[model samples]
Target chain A: MTSPPAVRLTALTRRFGEVEAVRGLDLTVDRGEIVAFLGPNGAGKTTTLDCVLGLSQPTSGAVEVLGLPPREAVARGLVAAVMQTGGLLKDLTVGETVRYVGSLFGHADRSSAVLEEAGIADLAGRRVGLCSGGEQQRLRFAIALLSDPALLLLDEPTTGMDVEGRRAFWAAIRRDAARGRTILFATHYLEEADQHADRIVLISHGRVVADGTGAEVRALAGGRSVRATVPGLDETLLGRLRALPTVDRVEARGEQVHVHAGDSDLVARHLLTATDAHDVEITSRNLEDAFLSLTQEAR
Target chain B: MSTPTHPADAYDPAGRTPPRWGGFNRTLLGLELRRMLRNRRTIVFTILLPAGLFLSFGSTGQASDRVGSGNVAAYIMVSMGLYGAALTAAASGAMVAMERSLGWSRQLRLTPLHPAAYVVTKTLVALAIGAIAIVAVNVTGLLQGRPDMPAGTWVACAAVTLVSTLTFAALGVFAGYLVPGENVMQILGPGLALLSFLGGVFIPLDVGSTIWHIAVLTPMYGVAEVARAPLTHELPWYAVVNAVGWLLAFVAGAAWQMSRDTARV
Candidate 1:
């Protein structure tokens, strides 16, 4: 038997006067899964999340969280959200904020445990507004986890964080996922999605353009690039490199000539035999390339 | 093999069922009350401001003159109390506007708490604050050689204060919602104060002309009239009806606007 979805949106649409913020967006998140929602600013990512959280009603669609409406699910303590601003009471201490949120879910001790888990136990007595942005983010994460919610809705979970902070944050998210909590997060950070998401859903212009694994979405770019830095290169060799069947495009910058090809290894092997080709370094196509290609294709 | 389910999981501990009054409303009320109490300035303004005004106004006339005649001291005491009520109403409106401007209301809206709870909580906070202000004013008046009005009048005043607070709180909420953040106080504070003064909170209705008569048609006038009736024993039926009507109108208008706001979000 298949487990029920943590959240499901069927043709969800939200209109703000003449402008349609979210249009016919259908999506689902299952228990114990991490789904990343990728979209540019004003692409209905937040609106969709708001709808699933029951903060906003769909203009013409239905949304369910843990087999109930979003508001019902929230009352039942089945869903928790970590919004962009963290939504914490500024005057309250960290512990107080967590306890307040936990009390709403009928669990007080859970707040402390969640706080410790989020690595902010020492700052429990500190006021939330006095804390740094990263600290506030962690506090929100702790609060979101206080209810032991089955589903977590995180919007831009780590937008402004140092490299190490983001890694630690991702570790906490992974820990939560390990405990069987389904997470659906919207973020512009492609690397976070690529590294942590079990599945990614790309939204643009108030619609879902792509939904698949990191590798699957990357495959949407068709082929990979064979970027090589040759110590010495000539136009004859560049022309010869571009003539390769696997090579789609070629650009020469000074002594280094970069090649976009279906097979990087084959291109590198052919480049090694060239008279002026020396010290050729081939790299894999990253998510940036895939994202640019996908967004371009979407447009 | 046995499937394990936690004891807390078997039964909904938080009473997962939709509350008769709704959790959102309760939570909203809870948060609003806590926030209001937490602010030292708000507490001082809500409780002390009216009390001080009433005491200063009440002490001007000797206690013997205030006994049966219900002279200017008693009259001004009632008016000052009404002024406090108006201030409370204006403050409540400003508070809501400030909360919205600071994004606190939006944050609360994202919670599982129901929308009705949010509205009800805010209304209750305003009412509670208004009651505190009214009590402070009357208690101070009593201490300043002004004897208490009859229990019946006191109860009537309390009831009036409650209804007036509700009506003004609703108006405040509407103002907060409608007014832009930067111009909230500029629009609501002076606007409410002007209405209150015109409605006879500052100047007596009998002293003013056709405009004051027109002002008596406002919600604040009705509230002031109802509040002063027990103390002065001069109940104006038309003013009471007008206040009740305005209160109902504010409620309807607020409900409509809130529903539209929520739907738009």
Candidate 2:
């Protein structure tokens, strides 16, 4: 039989006391596929990643990484991760951190190469505490590369990075993917998912809301939101907007009203002519709009 | 991005051998030892404090009074040595609290490192620190040359002191998992000092006295009695029971807390 998918989660559910953080989520990612896990805050992305890393156990359901249990795969050095924050010791220099983790894998000599790949070769002598947030993130990335894992998991790996740093980081990741490494990353930046990921798995409230290519996800969301400053938006106007046959969601924020509908031109015309709306704008949907609409629908 | 030049065969997981010892390599242990030794607090609490206490209090004992195989000064020296080793081991073990707070333990879990291996490594590191404290006190005793003990007795006292201090190392790990990172040593430091006083490590208590009966039950009492056995030539069954019982209890406690720690979100 051919090797199993890089990662597979079947009906994964995790609970924290009374709070059900992850509820019956399912997903599968093939080898060498760059899958982006997209979700809003508190959408169980980190929780799911933790389970895949075996840092936390699933209350129910099965998680497989590299055709084996998560912990087993990890222990075999087939899986590695770059977690979000606070893993580095403040006292050790960057080189020492990389070397120390490398030693755990019996590959201390590879530290310099990984550091160079992570664009932190010059930072070897800098103490982790003294490094900037972006620098620290790069250091974490370097440490993850020490084992040359087959499947890599990154949880918000570039959160604190600068624009240039983010660019360089993705370059390194792309190079790894080209080497047949399966990469799964959880990120808040929709643009990163759109630009880099071959597939996007969007989760909301511990469930997969959408899973496809970026364009496919956007097409699946399939609507534009007409946003305008409405001075007198009341329940009557909201009700009227909700009554529209084409509209999917009607939301109000401060003096602005957002009406999501398939026909944005018709919606914009209705707002400009039929109601007292200013700054009437009709815009095409982007990944952000798609992310918001999909997650909103899940809720 | 540069394309990977190597063929996909290089990515095969089957080609690699799994790490031995559950990722408990000597390199990690070496790094841990260096970090602990570099900590100024470790030096002050483990080495200087014990030696300083021995100098200050041990000097007051009359050199003429003989207790068992050595003079009163030597008995006090052994007691101080045991006290230092226990404190050092416990403090070293509790360093896990800091590692946990830093999320380092979580990171290690993501690696191939087993929880048992982590504990074993930490315990071994603690034992190493305990050895240093014993050596510091014994060397201080040797320089003074007033303890009046045979070379064999000194060797025996140091060895027993180092080995029995493993109880405190286990206790430290248990407390490390029990309390928050910043407060672990704060609570354990005073707690150990109190145990020392109760165990009669710092003072002589009459046999069968009310305090002596309570002392025999304290964790440190047995360790103190056992370490000083070479110098004092007295061995009680109850002291051995106390030492062994606490060791098992602390190890179990540490294991339970470690399981819970790994299961946490």
Candidate 3:
């Protein structure tokens, strides 16, 4: 028999007046794993995270974090969150904010170490409001880590961060995961999930439509791409390629002909022989393509 | 081959634990006291306002042989204490309101800090502010050589003032919680003004007939009646009991509303 997950949702449902923000959503995040929640704006990503953080109550069903009810887990200092807005006091210096939060969790020295680990040691004296968005995000992460919580929920953690900042943030998360912390993060940026998540759950219209490993979910897109730099690509050949049984879509840009099809290898061989196309390149489908395809298919 | 240890694994020392609360209320009270003292605006309004008003009132009776003239000077001195209580209550409410607006309360709710701790912190902060206001009022009044009220009267008056501040602070918290942010100032401004006037903070409760009777039934009126008994050497058992009762009711009501609100969120 398997042990229970670090975080689990059993048919969770939350309604706000007339609208259902989250509906009968079931998920489980195992210990020492990073699960990325993928969704667009107003897709109930934040709402679900709020439920997990005990910031919002589910209208029906139940949620458990670290084997306890969400609110109970929070009271026990078993859960931590890095919200999109950072949520640090503006008047307080970075060090002061960390210390204040640490005191709340009954840990003072742990905050300083978390700050150092997040690479914001030099920013201790700066007021939280004066720091840049990336700096504030790092500080929020540091504060969340102060309690050594069993579950960490990050809602759009890298929304405002630049590319480099995001890379560093993910690296930190990976480090934490390696030490047996469970992380459930939500992000609209598919690349973050693709690069980091052990499993990905895709939500739309307050429901989970896809849940699997990166490769498994990508397979839901059901096709690969074949890009060929053909010497002469004409509309007639493009039409012929588009008519093939395996082909999903066809695009012609300058000297290159890109084909979206079910089997790129099979399509590439046919394209090479049929159009005498050379310089063929076959690439695996990316998360962006998979997401668009999946969402479109759901619609 | 040995596995590479991650940065998070470096602190894998077993059996490390953090400290828990010794006495929950005392720790919360001490923290609240520190916060109140550190707040510059609270210090100014609580401490400075009382001193300023006392000086303005005390200087008038300094030249007169008859200290308790029951005129503007006496009225101002008494009113100064009432104002101090009102200001402390208002400041307490504003601080809690500001915390809610800034999401601090919601964040704090996630911690091991109990609901009682949060409420006690606010109450203690208000009490500390009230103490400062009372001391400033008495010191300024004494410096001006206004006939010193009896020590027993001062003690009675301070107790009533503290209770009144507590009651008003709870009401302020309720108002801050119920009212929307855009209309906070408008709601609190008119309501506080009316309480101050009707409760006899500025004008004596005996000025009107039917209106005076009705105003005396108000929470502030009960506060003022109890607070002034010590100064006037006219301690009324009914007034003190009523004031204490109202303070308890306000605290109970505010706590109920806040806890319900927190649970809903």
| Most accurate candidate by TM-score | 2
* Predictions' DockQ, in order: 0.27, 0.35, 0.31
How do the candidates rank by DockQ, highest first? 2, 3, 1
Regions of candidate 1 where Cα sits further than 4 Å from its true position: A10-26, A59-62, A106-109, A162-164, A227-259, A263-282, B1-21, B24-31, B62-72, B182-190
Tens-digit lDDT track for model 2 on B1-265? 2234533445666766667887788788998898889888899987899989888878884864989888988888889888888888888878786788789987787777777788788878888988888889888888887788888998998899989998998898889877867678888889999999999899877899999988888999888888999988998999989889988998889778867776664
**Which residue pairs in candidate 2 collide?**
none
Candidate 3 residue lDDT tens string, B1-265: 2135433233332223333651144444554566667667667777786778567655653434332323344445666777776776766776676667667776676566666656666777787778778777767766665535556656666776776777878777777777735355466656766877777776565645887767766677777776676555554565677677777886787677677766766
lDDT of 2 at B227: 91
- Across A228-299, the per-residue lDDT of candidate 1 in tens digits comes to 667657777888888888678998889777788877777888877654477667666677777777766766
* lDDT agreement with native, every candidate: 0.72, 0.86, 0.73
Candidate 1 vs 3: which has more lDDT: 3
Chain A TM-score of candidate 2 vs. true chain A: 0.81
Candidate 1, chain A: TM-score against the reference: 0.81
Cα lDDT of model 1 by residue, B176-197, tens digit: 6787464665676568768877
